[model samples]
Every structure is written in structure tokens, then in C-alpha cells.
Target: MGTIKRDKGLDNTLKVMKQGYLYITNQRKRLGSENIFETRALGGKKIIVISGKDAAELFYDNDKIERSGTLPKRVVNTLFGKGAIHTTTGKKHIDRKALFMSLMTEGNLKHLRELTRNHWYMNTQKMEQMDQINIYRESIVQLTKIGTKWAGVQAPEEKIEEIATDMDVMIDSFKGLGGKFKGYKASVDARKRVEDWLEDQIIQTRKGKIFPPEGTALYEFAHWEDYKGNPMDSRLCAIDLMNTFRPLIAINRFVSFGLLAMHEHPITREKIKSDDDYAYMFSQEVRRFYPFVPFLPAKAKTDIQFEGHPIEKDTMIALDIYGTMHREDVFENPDDFYPERFKDWDGSPFDLIPQGGGDYYTNHRCAGEWMTIIIMEETMKYFAERVTYDVPEQDLTVDLNSIPGYVKSGFIIENLREVV
Candidate 1:
């Protein structure tokens, strides 16, 4: 075994900042190393960036790496929330994760899909009255409504826009420096208000002041018990509830990419309209081809070695999610957008993780992934068959340097019309 190659620099923090999603893969190509390399980032913190299927498998091993203390403090405060499930491990993680997994049943998924389709129809009707709309912006508002309602949280009709904007700002905070401070502020403020509201609901549910449908996420999470058979911390319960809500709204990014794919590959639109299976394929391709989550961070739980590289206990490691999905060996012509490639996909957990890899129930994989797919498939079918809108000439380039990238023009559309 050989020592892992290291990039020479005082620190690669600026390199990572400048390169964003391309940082790791670019270094791999320049150094000609076998999918593992070391660099310093974020104020000179030693980070081992790893890619490829086997590396991902190793990275997710619970005994080797742990999620706690891996994410940036700012990230936890802004995006994930303090005490969120993303920060737990062992039996605590399993018990908390079960609350989320329980809400992912077939009946619940069908209910979410119905809510999504209904919201889309209402939003499209409103859009038809206007001259143009940004699908990315519209999706945030629409999906927020669907997410809040389906999760059994009640938002007044008037406050949905405010709540939606806060969620959007929280996600946007993880990206560029220009908006980072403002995004952080928004996240802090939003968490306080949202958590306060959710705590009230949890209290109401516990006291019978309000009854969320028994099987709904709101009620389940409100009443969920921890490993000690005590009710979860009210604030933590609220944070976990937002975990279910926020990611659904964040699917707007993928929805925007899905629209871009259809516009670029017009032929696929007809196939998407005619074949349900094809729509699912198109959704998978969009996830693979786009840049959403760039990387996932974890910490070495104990001194360990991978491919002869010694990782000290508590050393930070980054799994290159973008690089793995685009690895040439794993994905043929990986840069090209091709939906048909998924027709015979082998379903390897590590190969195609736009979300985190490994078993959802036991690992740190995004619990809301199935709900994301259901929403995307429904959105594709809606755009293909039930709605018609013109994609006006606009900048459609996706900036690789942007974390959670978006179409440059947010996928503008005009002259919206309902097919019915």
C-alpha cells in the first residue's frame, strides 16, 4: 500500500472556495492519484477527500467514521439546526431516524404526492395570470406550502411566503461568501421563529389542544420518544420536523434542473409524457447530472488507514458526492445527460448517491430521499402533460463553483397555459 498523495499549499481552503464542487476531482486529475488525496481546507483543517464506490463504502462505515462534529459550526446553526438528527450517533441516531422512517410509508407518500400535485396546479393557475415566472422561485413557495401542510403544520395563508423565503435563505447560506453572512442571519432568525411555532404545535398535540392526524409526521414527531422512553426535547423535535419540511422545499433545485433537462432534450418530454417509467428515469438522470449536494463530511472515529493513508482519530474527511456520481468508470460518458442509462442501473448504494449513500434507516442518508423522488416524478409528469410554458431565451448555464447550483436564469418560462 502507498501513502495518500498530498496537495502542497499552506492550505487549500481558498482552492476549495474558488473551485467549489470541482475541487477534489480536479486535484485527483492533476495529481494522478487513485481516488484518495489529502489537503487542508477551512482555515487549515486537514481533510481527506475520497471518491469512487469503494471509498464511499469505507467512508460510511459507522465504526470508522462518525457524523458528529464533522459539519461546520455555521452549517449546523444555519442549515441543519442545533441538535438535529444529523448530529447524533449510535442508538440515539437509530431511534431518532425511526421517527422519520415511520413517516415514509406508502400511504404517507401517496398523500404527499397528492398535496404536491394540488399545489402545482394552484401555482400554475396563478402563473397563467402573469406574463412570466421563474420556476425555481415558484417551486420554493409552492413546495413550502405542500411540505408544511403534508407534515401537518399549519401556516396561515398570509405567512407562507415569509416562511418560504426563510427556508430559501437558509439553503442559500451554504454557498458563496457574498451572501453567507446574510444567509446565516436569516437561518438564525428563521430557526427561532419556526421552532417556536413548532413547539407550540408539539405542545398542543401532547395536550390534545390540537390533534394532527395520528399518522401524520407532525403528530408522530411531536409524540416520539427517545431511547430513554421520554419525549424528545421540544426544540430538537422542532428541528427534526424542519428536517422533514426543508428538504422537500429544497427539491425546488432539482425541479429546476428537471425543467432544464426537458427543455434541452425536448424529445425526452414526449417520452416522459407517454411513459411513467421514462419519467422516473429522467428524474434519476437529473440527480446524477446536476450539482446539488457537493460533498458530505464526517470525522474519523479512531485512528484508521485507507489505501495506506493514516487517518488520525477525529480527522475530518469529505466524501466527494459530485465526483463519485460523475466518475467515468462508474458512469459512462458521465458528463453527458442521458436518461436511458438508468434503465439497467445495478442499484449500487455508493455509485449514484446524489443524496448520502448506505442504508437509509441505519445510516446518515437523507431520510426524505424517497419523498424527493416522488415529488420529482410528479413534477415531471405535470410539466410534460398537464402544463405548457415557453422557455424564453435566458442564461441556463449552471455554475459549478456555486454550492447548490441553480440555472443562471432560474429557468424562466412565459405564456403559461394549462393543457386541460
Candidate 2:
């Protein structure tokens, strides 16, 4: 009998080192490796990393590689559905991404940022009334309501509150609540609410009761195609938008965390605040330090041999963002939260990927990364300077199995009594 080895849930890649890539173990006990030269994990699912700028290049490389198969698709269908971003790959993914990018131009983004600033100011003003507030949770609710709504999507306020409540319930359950059964129930309930809301929105938009602006990414995505080449039905587009929206919500949740990091590390915060381009640098560093996603899961595309390892097709491969970010060989003082490190680095792009690199748009790369950076930079600076928060004794919690966390939304930010 073949004995099964359970997944140990370690930073799999971090534990093993080979010539080009580090090895990882899947649930099936398959081993794969990823490194500077090439990536072959889950038996033989293959990709290349090469260096830092290569990371970005790989992200933009759409023609040769794409996101497909069971793991990613299943997760998307379960969590995000067949939306414009996660549901499709290749040319279609590029087209959809292009639409999103085009809509994310400086002018549109500038407008979005202005509205966001107003929203943040308003929210923060309300928070100041209480000496102590849960900035993390409050930020999540505010960002979901204000952030996406400002981005031109009409997210229902009540629904946003419900989802926030559900998420918290699950988190509480994870932290060991006995009665709620919160994790399982919240996941199931949230999916239903998301589906119902998406259906209503699609029907409403189709009937012309609402119309997104002509160049709006969501508007374009309403007619996007899937890998099978059919235009995404309005229903699917609605579902997809929700999926895209979730990450934005999550990223913003951490934007508050980034602000906390900066406020605590005054020297780093002040340095970033002092320069124009440095704001972006700071945001990148924040992304690196407290990334929204740690494991980017992918499946093997075909059967192939790589680096003398025989990996079968269809195995699950999880790319390690946390490990890569902290790898000493790649970044000097790997654990330090230094935004300026990127400013001086001349390495390839593959080395520093908070976002997945190489053909990732069609794979697992984030569509809203540009907007995420913009929002983080804007939000981080605003809070670091204008708002001050008193964090609890815990600085950051290491999720060990998931994304790294520090100073979760458990603290209160004081000062600045009203939004302008």
C-alpha cells in the first residue's frame, strides 16, 4: 500500500533549495521546485522566474502561458466565479486587463483618489469621536463601501456590512469560537449573498436601469469572453466583478495595516512621505512586507520533465510570495521593512514578486494591482501623518500557514475629529 504523507503546511519552498528552484509538496505528495532560473513544481508544472524585473515581465507575458485547469478555476468559481479577471486567460484576459488598465489612467484614478480622500476623511472624522476604535475592521467596512463605490461600482451598503460581519465571524471561529461554526457557515452564507446580489445587478444593468460609464472597466468586462470564447453573460460578469471587488476590499484592509506599520516605524514612514516617487516605493514595500496573498495556487499544464524531477500533470503548485520576499539571497536584510531597497535594486523582476510573475494575468496575477498600489500609497500617507493610532500590545501576528500579518485591525487611531 502506498502511504500518504499529509501536507505539513510549512513554507514549503523555503525549506528546500536546489540549483534553480526550491521544492514544494502538494497534497498528493508531489514535489516541485522554483528559483531564479526556472520553476517546476507539482511534478512538472513549469515557469521561469529569472530575476526582479523578470517578475513584472512574466506577469505581462500572456501569449505563452495562461491560467487554466481545476485548482485555480475551482477556487475562482467557488470564491470569485467566472468574472473578467479570474475566469479567462490569454488574449481575452489581456483584453479585459487592458480595459481595466485603460480605465485606471491617471485622470480616472486621480478622480477616484479625490473621492477616496473625501470618503476616508469623512470616515476617520467619525472614528475620532471615540478614543479607541477597531481601525482594521472599520477600515474594512469603509473601504468596501467607499472604495468600490467611488471606483464607480454600486456596492450595496447593507450587503457590504453583512459580508464584513460574515468575514469577522469566520475569523473569530478560526481563532477558536466553539458555538458559531462560523467558518463553514460564513463561507456558505457569503457565497449565497454574493450570488443573489450579482444576479440582481446583472439583471438591473441589462435592463438599462443602470449603466456604467462608457470606458469603465466594469462596463467593458460585462461583455468579456471566457477561455471557451463566448462573451461572459451579464450574470457571470456581475459575479466576476464581485470577485475582483473582494481582493480590493482585502488589500485595503491591509492598507490600514500599512499605515500602522508606518506610524510605528516613524523613520521609514517619514522618509516615504518626503518624496513623490517614494510613496509608490513605500506601497510596494508594504505589499512586500504585508502582502494580501501569500500562496498563489496553480495546476500543472502538461506532463514534462524539469531539473531531473518527474512531475505529473494536474498537480497543485503554490508559489511562495512570503518566502521569496524574505529570501536573504534576493533581498539584503530580508526581514527588514525597507521600501528603499527596491529603489536601489537592479536585479531582474522575477525576484521581488508580491504579485505572481510571468504570464500571471492569465494565470493568477492580480488585475487591480495598479489601483491597489495607488490606494495604499494614498491611504498610508494620509493616516501615517494626519491620523495617529494606539495599537494594542500585539504588533503583528504571523499567520504561518497564510499571509503574514502584523498589527491586525484591533487598535484605535485617534485625532482628526472630522472629515473635510
Candidate 3:
């Protein structure tokens, strides 16, 4: 096997923290490797970064790559709680993932879509009464209520915003390492608060103090069993329960970006009002053009050769999710924010994976992906068709170097007027 150029650094953990989303893509460009490049990150471990269509295929291969011990401990305690679906693999993964897949049933997803639409409509009504509003924070409040209700988690309207605030703080901590000590501490505290609350709920349900309806996330997770038919620790079960509904609130970032897109492209904004199919394309474009997840790291399950070079077993590898979607070969004039590109696009899971590539039912792909698109499409539809507002002058720049990049101004809108 031939040797690929390796990054000249003893350890690249600091660089990865500094560069964030662009670290892998920048290295690939500098090394001039179209598909694969080598580097060391997260404390001098051998790591290879891969992009493009073929690389995506290999990255998601269950037999060739694994998820055990892939993510950093800080990310786990802060963003995704321990024992969440993002960590487990093999039969253990499949079994745990089934809990989420079950929640994604057509009936449940339809309910979620209806919930999204109703909440957006109400927010517009409220906005009409107010002088101005920040779409980012407002949508979080709206989605948190919707998500909690749909999951059968009994939380009051007043407490919903507080919970959303905690969840948002946890998600924002994963963006970059700047001021991470304070951010990390906040996130860890948030997780503990939420998890402790969820644990109490679990106990109440078991003791018959609270009896949530069957098939709801609260009820299912309270009774979910592992591969050995044993109940999960109450604390860990709370983590799994939190995973069921927290992702719905994450759609606030996409909603903020989608509104920004409409303001930037008036012609595209007007088109979605009349074309239902175009609205779907617009949502897809927002996911592609804007950044969400940057890269997903996995460990090589076996010794493998790619691009005439050897990748030893246990080597840390990452799939360049954001870079792959914007590759010139993958999408013509990829940098442009055109929704029409998806009109005739073939449905390949690997090409446009802001969420993750491969079969949603099987791989590490987000089970809530379909729900994300639905909620985004509904929110965009509401903004395009239901109301008219003005985008006030503000800093709308998107910082790509952040893990969960978003508009700097949170896409503020003022002078809300309803349209018949």
C-alpha cells in the first residue's frame, strides 16, 4: 500500500478545537487528496479524514467501522447523555435504536407534523401582538412545548421555556472550544438537571403516581429493557428518555437559517408560497447549504486499504459531512444557495447527509431526520404563506468554524403583519 501524507504535528487536538468544522476539509485541500487524507487528532491518535460519495459509503459500513469509544467524554456528558444512541453499536445499538424508530411511526410523525404547524401558527398570532421577536429563542419555546406534549412528558407552559433554555445551552456548548470551561460546566449542569428531573418522572410512573399513555416515549422508556431483558438504571433510562424529545427542539437552528434564506432570496421566498414541492426542495437546500453536524468520527473495525493506502484497525476516522455535500463533483456549483438543484436530484443517502448517511433505520443516521425535515418544511411553509415580516438590520453572518453554526443575529424579524 502507498503512503499518504500525514499532518506534521505531534498532537492536533488544539487545532481541531481551533478549526472546528473546517479542520478536516482544510487539511484535505492542503494535502491535495480528493478522497482521503491522514492526520492526528484528540491527543496524537492516528486519524484519517475522508470525503466524497465513495468515502461516505465506506464510512457507514457497519462491518468495517465501529462507534465504540468514538466521541469525546466531554461531548457525551454535555451534548448526548451517556448510553444514548450515538454511542452504542452491534446488537446493543440495534436494540436501543429500535426505541427511537418505534417513535418514528407514521402516526407519531404525522402527529409531530401537526404539532409543528399548530405551534408555528400560534407563534405568529403572538408575534402580531408584540413589537418584535427573535425567531431563534421563540421557536425554541414553541418546539419545546410541542416536543414535550408529543412525547407525553407532562410539563407546564411556564416550565417549558426553562427546560428549552437548558437544552439549548447544552447544544451550544458543543460549537467550539472558546471559553469551553465555563460552557462545558454549564452544559454538564444542564444535563444533570434535566436527567434528574426525568429520573423522578420515571420513578413516579413505576410507582403509579403518574401513568402516561401507552406507546408514548415517557411510558416506553420507563419500561424499556436491554438485550438481556433487564431494566436500565433509572438514571440511564432518563438519558434515553431525554433523547426521545430533545432533538425536536434542535430544529430551531434550521428554522432560523430557513427564514434567513427566504429574506436573502425574495424570488425563492415567493416561489415556495405557491409550490408545495418547491418548499420541500427549499428545506433540503437549507439543510445542505447551512451547516449542522460537521463530521462524525468512527474507529476502523478491521485493517483496511483505501485509495492504495493502509488504514490500520482501531484508527480514528471521520466522514466530512459538510464538505461532501458541497463538493463540486457531487453538486454542480455547490456553493450557490439554489433549491432547484434538488428538483431532479437522485435520492442518494450519501450525497446530502447533514444528518448522517446510510439507512435511517439501521445506521448511526438520526432517527429523527424525517421529523427534522417535516418540522422545517412546516415552519418554512408557515413563514412563506402565513405571515409577512421585515428582516431588521443585524449581523446575519454564519460562523462555519462553529460546530453547530448559526446566524449571528438569530434572524430577528419585526413589524409582523398577518396575511390572509
Whole-model Cα lDDT of every candidate shown, in order: 0.87, 0.54, 0.85
lDDT of 3 at 313: 92
Q: Report the Cα RMSD per candidate.
A: 1.5, 6.8, 1.7
Q: Tens digit of lDDT per residue, candidate 1, span 204-294?
A: 8888999888888889998887778899877888888889998888999999999999999999999998887998899999999999888
Candidate 2, TM-score vs. the true structure? 0.74
**Poorly placed runs, candidate 1 (over 4 Å):** 176-180
lDDT for model 2, on a 0 to 1 scale? Answer: 0.54
Task: Pull out the clashing pairs in model 1.
Answer: none
TM-score of every candidate? 0.97, 0.74, 0.96
Q: lDDT at 91 for candidate 3?
A: 86
lDDT of 2 by residue, 341-415 (tens): 878766444666776654333445566667777777777767755565555554455334332343544445545
Given candidate 3, what's the lDDT at residue 102? 86
Candidate 1, residue 183: lDDT? 58
Model 2 weakest lDDT span, ten residues long: 17-26
